[model samples]
Each structure stands twice: as structure tokens, then as C-alpha cells.
Target chain A: MDCISARSKNIKGKGQSKLKRRESLAGLLFVSPTIIYFIVFFLLPLAVCIYASFTNWNILSPNRVFVGTLNYERLFVDPKFWKALKNTLFMLIPIPIYITFALLFAYACHKNILGQKVFRAIYYLPYISSIVALTLIWMWLFNSKYGLVNNFLSLFVDNPPSWLSDPFWTKWMIVIMISWKLIGFTSIYYIAALKSIPKSYYEAAQIDGAGPRQQFFKITLPLLTPTTFYLLVIGMIGSLQTFVEVQMFAPDGGRGYGVGTIVFYIWQKAFSSSQMGYACAIATVFGLFILVITVIQFTLSRKWVFEGN
Target chain B: MKRKISPVRIIVFIILLIGAVTMIVPFAWMLSTSLKEANLVYTIPPQWIPKPVDWKNYIEIWTASNLLTGIKNSCIISVSVLVFCTFTSSMAAFAFSKLSFPFKNAIFVMLLTTIMVPLVVLLVPLFVIYTKIGWIDTLLPMIVPASMCNINIIFFLRQYMTGLPKELLDAAKIDGCGYFSAYWRIYLPLCKPAIVANVIMLFMITWNDYFGPLVFTHSESKQNIQVAIAMLNSHYIQQTDIPLMMTASLIAILPVLILFIICQKYFTESFAMTGIKG
Candidate 1:
């Protein structure tokens, strides 16, 4: 009887291992396509980019000479690169202000204000629209001569700044356009975050004689930190990569280097100038900047981003 | 309990109203300008409403530019990409969530890290590779790479699938269903909401993608609506026909606007889900 029990237990263990093996095979089979794709597109391209950053290879050239540290050194000294970096950083100014308004707008929508649904949908319209079309429309609106904005501004100011043409106002124009497009989309996220907050917390605050303002600061604000943190990171990364508006509005670096973003500068170097090596080097550095910033954001998020109880 | 019409609510309403107007004015201006003649566009007061609307600009622009062909190409490319990306991402998500595999965590982490590698970094090498493979001037470069996988979609679906019951797959397996069938019949059916959400999101990404088409396709006929519209400014830079540009912009945005309105619930809800889950 002891031998029989031991033999059955051994057979059961063998069957379980076989099942595990089959499951592993099945898993590999399921993920094979994605794995193949990642290898060909993601990994290979990344490998090529890293390699190309160290070489002087134009796209048309057959030979790529190894030039270690040369491209990186050039990037450090290049005034255009610095200007582009500054321009990219300049766009970060609106993010906090944008978040504040998005939060406030979301709060109002959460309270079920009149036409809340309609307003939310309307706000998301620009997000859905093509960036090219949106930029062109904005171009028309920012026209120095016949623009609706300037036309409106002429009613008070003697000289309205040329939004698209003027170097100083070019970054501001892009900022305004970016803000307009993102406000609706970001606010919707905040609205969802606000709604997810348990009503019981607000009720508890009220029971403790907390006013609406007190409830907001003490309860709602704390709860919304995770969402805010998410937006802040996303917003910063996105602003750093601002391209279409700046590219379309200020095609030639916006009348004396007002709106040349890092990506746009990279595109100009690689595509227009055919300086593929320099572009790759710039791209590598820009990517590292984004990575560093993102890592810092993640590290900082631990302090303020509320982990739900 | 009856809620009072508080002054705070009134203030909120006014603020939101102002925002709504700001949002709507661009489209309104586009429409207004598209109807006005070239000379009438630069009026002092700015014609909020055109005296004599010129619908000819739309007709003329549509006939002259690659607008119609662009629309057709954009629809085909975006739809194909949408379907392919959704399928591949979902399948991968299923494996990650349900199946027991060796080195699964390591593989997923590797894939996630690739998201940090921005598209701009890949631009030069991809351009060189595409040129080598003779994919430049073709839609294949744009469609094929984008279709293969999207990290965000996989992450989203994986997060969703993790919340699902393990017993469902177990029950299916107990009923003599194979792993593929479990995925196809059980998991796929259960994943409709997620799939719809992914579809809408992918549609927006593919449709709004200007940079890809612009870089890849050089031919006039192969260009998407965005490229076509952008070409309008370049080709007619000296002319500066604002009305024609506005008309083209209107046409370009119409499909997305209609789709957004129709899928309003899914569009908003999907974005909302991403924010919370992400």
C-alpha cells in the first residue's frame, strides 16, 4: 500500500511538469509575433541609432567612418543645439498653469455645472483634430494683418505683436496653441480622477465642519496628487517634444530662433541638411535628456503622488 | 436633497462658457474664412460672417490638390494600422497576463523600456534603412512598422487583463478548450470594451500622424491628407490664399470631428481609463 501511494504521487508530479512545459510553449507561440516585431523595428533601429551616433554617415553615403566623441563634442559646442534646447525648455512654462486650469475646469465639470457634457466634448475637439489642420487654422488666426486675434487686439492696443512673425511672440504663440489643444484632454483626466474620489470623504469633511474650500485643500487636493503627477510628467515630456505647431507656424526657426524645438531641429539637420550623423548625435542627447527628466520625475513622484490606501 | 443654485456654480458656468467659446472659435473662424473671398479675409473688423460666401474655394481646392486621394489613402492606411496594431498588442497582452512563460517579466520590462526611445532618435537610421530597402515613397514604411506593436496599447490591455478572473481560462481549459480557443473565444469576447478603447485611440494616432507620412512618402499621389494640406502652404507660399487653406483645413478635420462626436462616450471613457489605469 505504501509503494502504490508513492508511485501515484510521482506520476502526478510528472504530469504537472509536462503541463508546465506545454504552457511555456504556448506562451512563446502567442508572443512570437510581438517578439519578432520588436526585434526588427524597436531593437534593431535602436541599435542602428546608437551605432550611427558615433559615425559620420550621411544617408546617401556608402561608407560610414567611425568618429567617436566628435559628434558629441560638436553637439556641446553648437549654438543652434543650445538654442533648440532653450526653446524646448521654454515651452515647459505653461505646464503648471495648464494643470491648474485643467484641475479647476475638471472640478467644475465634476460638480455637474450647466452644459458640462457639451463643454467637455467641445474642449476635446482640438485634440481629435489633425495637428496640421489645427496648426494651419492657428496660423490663419495669428496672421499679423488679418488675424482674428490681432483684429480683436487692435480695438485697444495701437500695435498688436505679430504672433507668427515676431521672434519674441513665436514661442508664446506655440504655447497658446499647445495649451488650447491639451486643456480639454487633460481636464477630462482630472474629471475622472475627481469622480473616482469616494464621496464619503467629502461627507466626512462636512461632518467635521469643513467648508467647501477646506474640503478641497485637505481632502480633494491630496487625493488628486497622483493624477496631477501623471499629468505633470506627461505634460513636461510632451512640451519638450513640441514640433508640429512650431514647425508649421515658424518654419524657419520663427524669425530669429524663437520656436525651434529639439525634435524639429533634429529633423532639419537629418532631412533637410542630410547631416544624418549629427542629427543622430543630437537625437541621442535629446533622448538622454528626456530619459533623465523622466527618471527624476519618477523619483520625485514618490514624495507627492498619493499611493491609495 | 434639493441643491441650491449657488453663486459658485454660476461662476463655474461662466468660466466654462468662456473656455467653450475659446475652443469653438478656431473652427468657427475656419468656417467663416473658408466662405470669404481672398480680399474680404483681411477686413478691418474681421468678417465674423461673410457678406457673399465663396463656396468655390472648396470646390477649386478639392479639384486642384490631392485632397480626395489623401482622404482615401488616409482611411485605408489608418484602418489597416488600427486593426493590425490592436490584434498584435492584444495577443501579446493576453500572453503576458494569462500564460506562464519563462523570462516573461524580463521580456516585458525590455519592451516597456523601449518606450523611452523617442521616435526622433530612430528617424535617421529608419530613414537610412527604409532607403536601403527601397521603402521610401511608399506607405509600407509607415504602415508596417506602426502595425507591428504599440507599447502603450499592450501595457493598457495587460493591465486590464490582470484584473480578469483566472478561473475563466481555467474553466475553459477544463472544458477541453485549447489555449488558442481560450484566447479566441473566452478572452477575446470578454475584451470587447478594451478592444474598442484601443481602436479609438489607435485610430486617432494613425489619423493624426503627419510626421511619418511626410518623411516616408515623397510622391504627390501617395501623400496623406496632412501631407497634402501641408503642401498647400509650401506650394502656394507666394500666393497666400488664406481662404483656400482654410477650406482644406476644414475638409481635413471633418472626418475626425464626425468620428469623435459619434464615439463621444468611448473616446472620453477610454482616455479616462488610460489616466486612471496608467
Candidate 2:
């Protein structure tokens, strides 16, 4: 009887082991396509990009010769690169302003105010619209002669700036265009973050004799830090990569080449100039910049963003 | 529950009212310009409502260029990307969430790392790779690369699937259902809302993308609506037919507006989830 029972137990153990093997096999099979895709698109391209950054190969070049960081050295001295970098960084000036407005709008909406849903939908409109179309509309709106912006401004000021043509206001125009589109999206995110904050906190604060103003500064602002950090990082990354809007508004980079962003510069270099190697070098630097900034932001976020409360 | 309207409430309402109008003016203006005659576009005081509205600009722009073909191509590319991406990402998400495998954490971390790599860095390399594969000027560059694996989508879906009952999957296994079959017959059906929400978001991203189509697609017929409009913008600027350009711009955004209106909830919800997690 002991020998028979032991034999049955061994057979059952084998069956369970077979099932485990099958499950492992199934897991690999399920994830294989994504794994293959990542290798081909993400991994392979990244490796090639890093390598190509050190080479002097054009689009149709038969041979690639290693340049030993020549592209990187030249990039630092290149006026166009500096200009592009400046333009990229300049686009981020509106973040604080955008976040403030978004917070106020979100707070107002979160109050269960009149036309709350309508306000939310209206604010989010530009975010969902095609950027190309919106950029085009803004181009018309910034037209020196008949633009709605100038038309409205003309009523007060004798001379309203030519928003698109003038290099002076080009960055400002780009900032406004980006902020207009992003405000709604930012507000929506803020609203979501606000909703996740428990109401009991506010009730407790009120019982402790906190005024509405005090409640906003102490309770609301502190709690919303995570969302702010998120928006800041995302906003910075996006601003640094400003391309399509800049390209659309100023196809030639506008007067004195003021509106040329880093990504747009990269695009022009690669596609138009066919300087693939140089473009790759710029892209590599740009990518590293983004990654480092993101990492720093992540490291620093713990100081401000409340983890539990 | 009724309370008197405070002055602060009135102030907030006024501020929101102004903000709402500012938000909407662009679309309203785009639509108004689409209806305006060429001469009416540059009036001394721009006409908010165009007199003797010309609806012909829409038909004219459509027939004049590759606008319709661009729309068709956009639909084809986005839908394909949507279907394939959703399927593959969900499968990957399922593996990450449900199944135990060797080096799973390492692979996931590797995947997350790549999300920080800018697409700009990949552009030159991808162009070369695609050219080598003879995919330049083809839709494959746009569709295949995007459909490969969206890190964001995989992460989102995995977070979602983690909350699902593991017992259901176990029950399927006990009922003689294999892993793939269980995922197909049970999880896919159960995750329909999530899948649909992801589809809308992916569709929007794909459709609104201008750069991929601009670089990868050389032929006119292969271009999407955003690319088509951009090409037309430069041409129409020289053509000096502002109304035609405006008309094209309006048409380019129509699908997005319609989709957003229809699926605003899903859109906001998806964004909310992304924000909270990220």
C-alpha cells in the first residue's frame, strides 16, 4: 500500500511540473512579439544612433568614417545650435504661468460651481484639436494686418506688434500658442489630482479655523505638488522638443531665424541638408539632456511632493 | 443645499466665462474663415461672420489637392496602428501582470528606460534602417514602428490588469483553457472598456501626428491629413488663397473635434490615470 501511494504522488508531482513548464512557455510566447518589436525599433535604433553620432555619414554615403566626437565639439561652437537651444529653453518660461492658471481653473471647477462640466469641456478643446490646424489658425490670428489678436489690440494701442513676422515677438507667440493649447490639458490633470485629495482634510482644516485662503496655501497647494511635479517634467520635456508648431508657424524659422527649436533644427539638418551624422549627434545630445533633466527632477521630487499625505 | 451666490462666485464665473470664450475663439474663427470669401478674409475689421459666406472653399480644397486621399491614408494608418498596438501591448501587459517569467523585471525596466529616449535621437537611425529595408516612402515606417510597443499603453494596461481577479484566470486554467485562449476568451472581453479608451487615445495620437508622415512618406498619396495640410499650407501661402488654406485646416481638425466630443469622458479619464501614475 505504501509503494502504490508513493508512485501516485510522484505522477501527480510530474503533472504539476509539466503545467508549470507550459505556463512559462505561454508567458514567453505572449510577450515575444513586443520583445521582438522593442529590439528592432527601440534597442537597434538606439544603438545605431549612438554609433552614428560618432561618424560622418550622410544619407547616401557608401562609407562611414569615425570622427571621434568632432560633431559634438562642433555643435558647441555652432551658432545655429546655440540659437536652437536658446529657443528651446525660452519656450519653458510659461510653465509657472500656465500651472497657476490651470490650478485656479481646476480649483474653480472642483468647487461644484455652475457650468462646471461645460467649463471643463471648453478648456480641453484645444488639446484634442489637431495641432497643425490650430497652428494655422494662430498664424492667421497673428497676421500683422487683419489678425483678430491685433484687431483686438489695435483698439487700445496705436501699434500692435506683428506677431508672426517680427522676430522680437516670435518666441512670445510660440509660448502663447503652446500655453493656449496646454492650459486645458493641464487643467484637466489638475482637476483629476484635486479629486483624489480627500475632502476630510479640508473639513479638518476648517474645524481648526482655517480660512479659505489658508486652506488653499496649506492644504490644497501641498497636496497638489505631485501633479505639479508631473506637469513640470512633462512640460519641460515637451517644451525642449518643440518642433511642429515652430515649423508650422515659421517654416523658415522666421526673421533672424528666431523660432528654430532643437528638434526642428534636427529635422532640417537630417531631411533637408541630408547631414544624418550631424543630426544624429545633435539628437544624441538632446536625448541625453532630456534624460538627465528627467532623472534630476525625479530625484528632487521627493522634497516637495507629499508621498503619503 | 441652496446657497446665496457670493461675490467671489460671480468673480470666478466671469473669469471662467472669459477663459471659455478665449478657448473657443480659435475654432470659431477657423470655421468662420472657412466660410469667408478671399476678399472678406482681409477686411479692415475681420468679419466674425462672413457676409455672403462661401461654402465652396471646402469643396474646392478637397477637389484641388490630395485632401481626401490624405484622410483615407490617415484612417488606414491610425486604425492599423490602433488594432495592432492594442493587441500586442495588451499581450505584453498580460505577461508582465499575470505570468511569472525569468528576467521579467529586467526586461520591464529596460522597456521603461527606452521611454525616456527621445524619438529625435531615433530619427536618423530609423531612417537609415527603414531605407535599408526599403520601407522609406512607405507607410510601414509610421505604422510598424508605432505598433511595435507603446510603453505608455503597456504600462497603463498592466496597471489595470493587476487589479483584475487572478482567480478568474486560474479558473480558466482549471477548466482546461490554455494561457493564450484564456486571455483571448476571457480577459480581452472583460477589458473592453480599457481597450476602447486606449483605442481612442492611440487613434488621436496617430491621426494628429505630422512629423512621422512628413519624413517617412515621400509620395503624395501616402501622406496623412496633418502632413497634407502642412504641405498645402506652404503652397497656399504662395498661392495667396488664405481662405482655401483655412478651409483645409478646418477640415483637417473636424474628425478630432467630433471624436473628442463623443469620447470626452474616456479621453479625460485616460489622461487622469496617466497623470496620477506618472
Candidate 3:
């Protein structure tokens, strides 16, 4: 009765109060589930990770010990941290080359040359296969004594290097496996980007007497700036989180932190060592590290990522 | 991608062909070795062909242990995850793309921000929470997380939705369809390609992932196929005179590869929506 009277009185104001409040209420109700989920799952978990970094909270523990800055202090001095950081950097080295190959692969398929569908399916196999299985296969393939790679090399080179066993070779092996897995999906992305570039652009360039080489450089490359920029940002972020390949492939807990990329190192600390506090700290730092890079990438993309419009 | 199809273009094709072959060999090798005798697996030049092809590996692996049970467990987990993720994400995508929700931009931004937080960062803390809920060693930990709509998937559906003509939606509303009804009757059918891609991608992730399955499952009966394959040394890889490991690997990757092959077209298209399109 009170609500009815209020609405009826507000009717004198005209054209407003009858549906306005109800529409606002409906909108709130509609978005509530997703908002609740984000708060509980995404936001809360992040907060927990950040706070857990400051305190020693093991899964088995009865209570968290407030360790304060100790986790942070230990992370800085840890040589393993330095090695993992280096390994993480090395993992990113081949990404640009990988992206180039991806573009070539995409362009090939886009142009409809040479059993294109078959080729894309073939390229995409590794990406979709079980990573653990793929890593294990790579692990066996890199076997120093009897593996496929070394065995092939032995017909010419005397002592084919121990790819997984050695620290230096371990980095290369990880890079190769990572590249093999990602190239196809990324290629598909490039193929889509290529297709979106209408033929009119190329026709216009050709009429201006621009040959294929000149057309690619002047037209194709420039228009492709947005896609490439997107690839770089996502690719870098993805590569930095490269965990499973190292976790499974480079054995002996990934060779004394040699191939222990940031993620692998976190796994080592949290799961292997039971240093939950310090692991969370590493994860927190790593998150911030990635956050900074992504912010820079997004900022850069403002100037770099071109609008199709 | 340098230039036109010259003599160099032919050379590029050759190089790409070789690379593609290399990409596929691991899987082909996996399948072939599955049917071979164990002794032939490590032979010179890594035997491409096996003699007296032993097909018993599949039966031995499946029947000698609780692998069939594990396979069943994996299927249950993966299918459930797939259904939940697809349904929830499509709904979320609908809300983001169509409905005039309050603070939609803010919510979208918040969702996108999580993509930067690597899986590593979330794993430990999430582990802690799972342990609290006594979800360790059960499929719930893996299954539940799979439902938490990823930003990439939502954004993907959103982009595809954005490309769709708004008139279809407006016309539905004019004929008295509400938001959910229009989404169900209109967008659902039109977005079939994108939805299929999303399902295939998520299904592949769940089906092939050893990471979550490794942590969440422990018993051989609870193990997924990848874990089963990787832990070959324990299961049957050590059993000489059989190609059991190979058989398991082949069985493990078959479903996902088949799905990927089936959805290859849509996968390529919707994947482009994510990035790399001009």
C-alpha cells in the first residue's frame, strides 16, 4: 500500500517514476550472478594470493605464521630465482621467429596453396595434444644416448649433445617444444588477420606499380600492425607463464633451476618445497612483473594497434 | 610471408611442408608405436615400421589395470566441465554483449585483468582453497575451476556477437521476446560456429590437460589419459615385449585430435576473432 501510494504520488512528476526504478532493479538483478562470481573467484583468490605471500600458510598448517617481509627478502637473494629469470628470458627468444613462421603458415593457407587444410590440421595437432604427453615425447626425443634427435645427429656429428641433461641444451629443448605447440594456433590467428585484409588494397598497390615485395612492406605489413601487436602482447604474457613444458620435460626438477622459468620455480617452491609463503611471494612478484609488461603493451598498442575503420 | 609466389615461394612451401610434417610426427609416431612390439620401438633410425605388429598393447593396458575406469572418470569430468563452461560463458557473453547491465565496462575490465594473472599464480592459492573444501584428490577441484568463465572465451563470443546484425535482436524484442529468449532462439543458432569453437577448445583443454588432472587425481583409476601416458614407466612402459605406452598415448590423444579436426574450420575462424585479424 505504501509503495503503491508513493508511485501514484510520483505520477504527478510525469513520465518517470513508474518504470524507472523497476528497470534499474532489473538491471541489478540480471548482472548479479556474474558480479558475485568475479568477486568470489577472481578477485578474492587474487587477494588471498597477495596476502598469503606475507604469511607462512602451508596447506597442512593449523595457522599461518606472520612472516612479514621474510619471503620477499629470501626471494631477492635466491640464485635460483636469478637462474629462473634468465631461463624465462631465454624462453621468449624464439617467440618473434615463431610469430614470423606463424604468419608464413597463415598466409600459405589463406592463399589456398598446396593442400592447405591438411597442412593447417597437421600444424594444429601439437597444439591440441596433451602437453604432458607432448613434453614427455620431447623429453624422450632429446634423450642424449638413444633419442631420435641425437641418433639422427650421430650419423654425422660424433657426440650429439645431451639436450635435456645439460643446462644450456635444456633451454633450447624447452624453446623448441614451446614453439612446436604454439605456432599453429598463432598461425590461424594470422591467417584470419590476412583474410581480413581485402584484395582491394593489394589491387590498388599493384596499380601503383608496387611489386609483391613492395606491396608486402608498404601495405600488408603496415595494416598488419594491429594483429602483430596483439600477438606480441599475448605471446609474451603466455610465454612468461610457460610452466608445464619445463615442469615435465627438463627432469631432475628441471636441472638445478637452469630451465626453471619463473613458473617452474613457483611450482618448485609451492608444491615441491612446501614454502607456501615464499611461493605466493614469488607468484605475487611474477604477477606484478607481468602486470607491468601488459600495461606497457596496452599503452604501446594505443599508438601501435591500428583501427580497421 | 615476405612476397609473391616466386621461386622463393616454392622454397617456402617446401620448408613449411617439412615443418608441418615435424609437427605431426610426434602424434603419428605415438599412434604407430602403439601397435608395435616393444623391442622395435628403440631400434635404429627409430623404427618407422614395426614387425609382427603387436595390437595387444591396447587390450593389455586397458584390461591389465583400472585404465578403463580412469578413462570413464576423465570423460565424466571433461563432459561436465564442457557443458558447464559453455552454458555459463554463453550466458555471461550474452549479458556483456546485449543486456544493458550496470557497470558493464567495469565488469568486463575486471574479467580481462585476470587473463594476465598466470595460471602459476592462481594454482597455489587455489590449491589452498580446494584443500579447505576437501576437494583434493577429487575431480571437483579441476571440474569447478573449468566452470569459472574465462575472459578469453567470453570476449571471443562477444566479438562474434558484435559482428552479428542488431536488427535480428531488435526484431525479436519487437515480437515480444525477452533478453534470455532472444539469446536462446536467435543468438544461439547464429553463434553456433563460435560456440562450437569454444566447446572444442575447452573440451581439448580439459581432455588433454595433465596439470590439473595430475594434482586433483592420484589413483590410477582416477588418472586422465595424459597422466596415464606420462606415467608410463609406472603403469606398463617398464613392461618389456609390449608397446603398451604407445597404445595409451594414441588412445589418449585420439578424442581431442578428432574433435579438433572436426571443428577445424570454426576453430580457425573464431580464433581469428581473438587476434591476428587485420
TM-scores of all predicted structures? 0.97, 0.97, 0.90
Alpha carbon deviation, residue A291, candidate 1 (Å): 1.0
**DockQ values for all predictions?**
0.75, 0.75, 0.51
Please, what is the whole-model Cα lDDT of each candidate in the order they appear? 0.86, 0.86, 0.76
lDDT of 1 at B207: 79
Off by over 4 Å in 3: A1-30, A300-309, B1-6, B63-66, B165-176, B233-242, B276-278
Scored by lDDT, model 2 comes in at: 0.86
Error (Å) of candidate 1 at residue A17 is 2.5
Q: What is the interface RMSD of each candidate, in Å?
A: 1.4, 1.4, 2.9
TM-score for the B chain of model 3: 0.87
The DockQ value obtained for model 2 is: 0.75
- Lowest summed lDDT across 10 adjacent residues in model 3 chain B is found at B233-242
The DockQ value obtained for model 3 is 0.51
Q: What are the per-residue Cα lDDT tens digits for candidate 3 across B58-137?
A: 77887655557767877988888888777777777776776664677887898767777777777787787877788877
Q: Which digits, one per residue and each the tens of the lDDT, describe model 3 over residues A160-223?
A: 8898667788788878787878889788777777777889999998889999889888877778
- Model 3, residue pairs in steric clash: A193-B277, A193-B278
> Considering chain A alone, what is the TM-score of candidate 1?
0.96
